[model samples]
Target chain A: MSEGLTFHFNVDGEDFTSAGQASVMMKKNLRQLGLPPEIIRRVSVAMYEGEINMVIHAGGGVADVNVTENYVEIILTDSGPGIKDIEQAMQEGFSTATDSIRSLGFGAGMGLPNMKRYSDYMHIDSEVGKGTTITMRVNIN
Target chain B: MTVKELAETDIFSPVTLPCGGREISGVYIGDLLSWVMGRASSGQAWITIMSNVNILAVASLADTSCIILAEGVTLEQEIIDTAREKEINILKSEKSIYDIAVFLSKII
Candidate 1:
């Protein structure tokens, strides 16, 4: 397979239990494509963190993954309450998630940081009233 | 210690898989995400009551051997299925996360 691969999914925020389905499926699909384990792990982890953020922070979102020879690009866009402070949101141990979300073991405030840590590149665009869109890329090399 | 030993020590019985049990290793227990992210090693079994899919995501990033969900917690099927597909072993027990962590630390 010399061509690039692309995959897309609609992340449902209604059910917190099913939040990471898209990332999980993508991880499996990338592994089946025979990508390196490191690459697959990075892509999945980055995408998974992004997916969780979308669920916990935004109501729902759309994720598009473009896999090419050089790198894998993940674009996650959400239509929910936007981030008021990206800097604070990126800080470790700083979370605005409700107690209910914390009980589920998330909302540790590690979502955005984790995404940035695992991805080769990351970009965030958001407004207070508008929704947020995050672009993250993990290199295949 | 192996997960089987964890099962025996704790009253809770977790579903078992044979991917990473052959390699017995240490255990890490913490709810603090930052510490775990930077310090948790590969091949060490992570014991946490945290049941979010992010747990699986963190485990993947840390390259952990498996994740043990304690305190009689029931993980969402998405988490179980995701961990399974990722080849990450997931176990659930009746023991609290604290109790299992202490027990596993002494054994390993």
Candidate 2:
């Protein structure tokens, strides 16, 4: 537990229903590691929002979680359509998701905002037509 | 009151009550998954019109007592099965969102 314990998953881009499985499993893992409840909730919620965003916007991506003594880090990388404007995407109630995505109770433009809300630090890097990478960390203290 | 007791009141019908013993202290209502995830307390009953599997993730993440699907929103069989396996409690109500919230306010 002194060094970083890493976990990785390939988020399936095809199925909408299968999304968030990675985040759910990571919650269990964090529980077994005996992290604080609030910390676990923050990491789970942040990772879950990121996972959902990947499913809805990107074609799917990779989620890597690194747990260490100081903090838990979540990295999401997607190859689907890249976000054209990070500023607009981060605004609440603003979304590029279609009507169908909204019908599913997602795409409220809360995904990235929620991720940022729950995490201690967040960074996003994206190039339109290239890909997007999101990094978030929740401090243990 | 526990979730089991709330389901027994008959206003909220049980879809599956795998973790019915969780205590209910308050109520929080919302449909947006992310909104509910951050705002819903750990021990409140979450009322929503959304009937997707993602609700399960939100309930578990927020650690809510149970999910009350307002407006008589029913869940699919597969989702119900998943709820059971995941040990999440779920209930449905024929009442509208507001009426259900009022009822919950009085009872819980």
Best by DockQ: 2
lDDT of 1: 0.77
Tens-digit lDDT string for candidate 2 (B13-51): 789998888899799999988889878888999999999
What i-RMS does every model get? 3.6, 1.0
Task: Give model 2's docking category.
Answer: medium
True contacts kept of each: 0.21, 0.67
Where model 2 places Cα greater than 4 Å from the true spot, the runs are: none
- Per-candidate RMSD vs. true structure? 3.7, 1.1
DockQ for each candidate?
0.34, 0.78
Worst window of 10 by summed lDDT in candidate 1 chain A: A102-111
Runs of candidate 1 exceeding 4 Å displacement:
A1-3, B1-13, B18-25, B32-42, B51-63, B71-99, B102-107
Best prediction by TM-score: 2
Instruction: Note the Cα lDDT for every prediction shown.
Output: 0.77, 0.91
